[model samples]
Target: MKFFKTSLLLFSTLLILFSCRTEEIQIIDPPIENELAANSTVAKLMKNTVAKDGSKDNIIDKASCLSVKLPVTVTVNSKEITVNDEDGYEEIEDIFDLFDNDVDAIVISYPIEVILSDYTVKTVNSDEELQRLAENCTGENEADDDIECLDFYYPLKASVFNANLELILTITIEDDEQMHKLIEDLEDYSAVTIEFPFKVILNGDTYVYINNMQELEEALEAAKNSCDEDDDNDYNDDDCDKCSTEGIKKIFANCNEWSVEKLYLNEEYLTEEFKMFTFSFRENGSIKIDNNGDISEGIWEITGEGNEMSFSINIPDYPAFNGTWYLHEVKEDSGEVSVHLLLEGNHLRFKSQCSTVKDGLNAILLAEGSIWAVESYKNTGEDETAVFADYQIYFYSENVVKAKKDGAVIEGVWESLNDGSMLALNFSDEPVNAFNKEWEVAVMSETEVVLEANDKRLVIKRIN
Candidate 1:
């Protein structure tokens, strides 16, 4: 009886040990590349659509070398849609909003018309001949009477991909009153043209036409101006437009259109000299945050119109943080613009907002207190210039100061006191950059200040 009882106890212990010793299941994380495969595929697919149907395909393959003469006004179905404002007044406002929000591209549709002016289609070897032809074709008397220049005509009706992936043809159609008859003629002409060893793709449908390359380029230029960004012109606000026309009529003669101007924070502030926290939008309609400032190229998304602009930015660094920005509230006829930004679940601040005038000029110079930064004087004293990685602080406005050193950030209110003609900075705490460490705003004249906690002696000159 004792032996049997011992055996039963031993058997139970072995069973328990076997159950406890089950193989450990490892939960390995997915590969980074694999995790983003779905999104990457979608982007590639979008590229394919544009490349396949658009001029990019031809550019890549080197098969059909067609250089589109820009600024060529096109008309579709007797509608005038686009114009060229050589001064960039038409596109500046949208451009600024685009940069501020971090948008790359969008699909917009519009009715268009193209006037088939005299042009020469040629190869790279015939560039000079083409130029000569263009020069010869200039002036009304030089235009060929045999070929109707006034009649918009399509040489090729549709584009088809060749075996080498080159665009075989760019579709064109006649801008004429008899488009119905023209379609019927095209159907029969192909039957005869095939015998002559020519194959043409037919443009059977029409919805939207790509804006003339020249016009699109011009628009981008206007946008670049609107953002008030000058890459090579850093530290010189000499030509910078501080304000943007949110929605104002820019008139040139009888032709008038509405445009907006925006301040480009990207260009105004030094990206390399200072660390910037970037926020962007996500595919899931949520804002993504990135602190590293890499992973995706930044894009600004601009929505709404006129004085009211809903701005959003997407940064490759901060994938999770995204939010909407707006102009500050103003009474009608006040002609005041207040820029405001809202990050998800975060308190709103002044740095996020920028104010502008009806003419798209920043209102700061005209404001009671304008927060501006000028060129810095070269430090002669034995001191280290502010180190960005180890320690930094961002003083955006009189009320907000964010200080950071060694990967930690502290935020609080701040103030600047006036001593005679100079301005002195006083923070809520000793800034991470150090208080006694001196800095100067290099204006036209010399101004110096010895900074201390809650007190400073400053000499400054204002240049408008």
Candidate 2:
């Protein structure tokens, strides 16, 4: 009687599990066909990455391997770049292939720096190069789908050059400890990341599948619209309201550091970096204050809502921080955005962060790797390119700049000024051209950077 009861109970449990899992746990449903819209690399990976055996297979493992689609963001140098781009394949190296699925996407953030060396850096930016790197994987271990991988290949390559425009090492110093170890033995500047994204499967119904950015966006749009919604439903008032002033608090709450710029108090101005203050707000309602070498942690909150709000800083040692801060303004233009605060009784109108680490790296990258010639210069309301067009400007390591014209090379120091909105150059002997002073960068792109000063405009370009 005991043996018969145990068998009956086991049979009942198996039937229940099969019925429950038959329900499609789909966040998305691709065409019900064998054809998968994957790149050659992803297709091969998917073909070999078998799904886990559920209760039906009677080989159930006590692990869940499911793939769900969601928005993935990558913040590089304080700029949130929606990672719409995908690179080469990564070697599969899981001892048991954690979930029976191939890695369709990976999000990595690394500290970006340039290594200046004498040898040229050969970076991969194409599909062919990726295949070459895959062939060079070291471990040759047993990976999922019978696909073996031993390493990763990052897409972007950062290199530094010397004044004479010489290739340095491809990799350099890394801030993140894990990334440091990964590339410490290799050559190049390194990027940093603390943790990988972790997720848990809700049930056995979840299984990894092939998907891409376009499909993910479509799913988000569908969720937003709810095309099959009933006409009797009502929308929530809070969902359609204009953005509240309290929203600024959440922006600061992110991990990025905000620099104090454009400080004013009681009609008197002060250094933007006065007191050498740097603010780091955490996502958990905690904030950090760093001045020179002194650092402290405390909690912060915003009390007001809508168009009016006040910032409250709670730190025991810092009594000067006790003040009601007003929302002076919020500005977004030309791909740059920032927040400002005003203390009514105090002479303070403080601007928040606008520059990013990527911005600095971009300026450096563009300034180097090119021999810029003057395409147009309008100073004193005259086209002066005819005269300065012969000048070739070269940016190099250590903020050094060299302008070569008429067999004479004048060396100067170039730096990013005014919250990275301006490029300033101070030469040992200032040139007579219009670009020899502080220039408000009106345009910065991969091909060119436009500068304006005193109602005058300058265009520098790389034609090669």
lDDT of 2 by residue, 1-464 (tens): 01112245643543442222222222322222322222333233322222221111101111112111112233322334443322111011111122235332232333221111111123434435433533432222212232111111122122222222233222221222222232231221112111111111112111111144334223333333322211111112112124354456545542166555545555455644454777776766687888877988877676666545666667666654556666544543333445555565343323354544235434543554677777888877788778776788887767887888889988888877655667887766545333668987655655677677776877888664
Q: Which RMSD values do the candidates have, in order?
A: 30.2, 26.4
The per-model lDDT (C-alpha) reads: 0.28, 0.42
Whole-model lDDT for model 1 versus the true structure?
Answer: 0.28
Q: Which stretches of model 1 miss by more than 4 angstroms? A: 1-116, 120-263, 266-283, 287-464
Per-residue alpha-carbon lDDT of candidate 1 for residues 397-431, written as tens digits (9 for 90 to 100): 34465656666766654443221112233444443
lDDT of 1 at 300: 50
TM-score of 1: 0.17
TM-score of each: 0.17, 0.30
Candidate 1 backbone clash number? 41
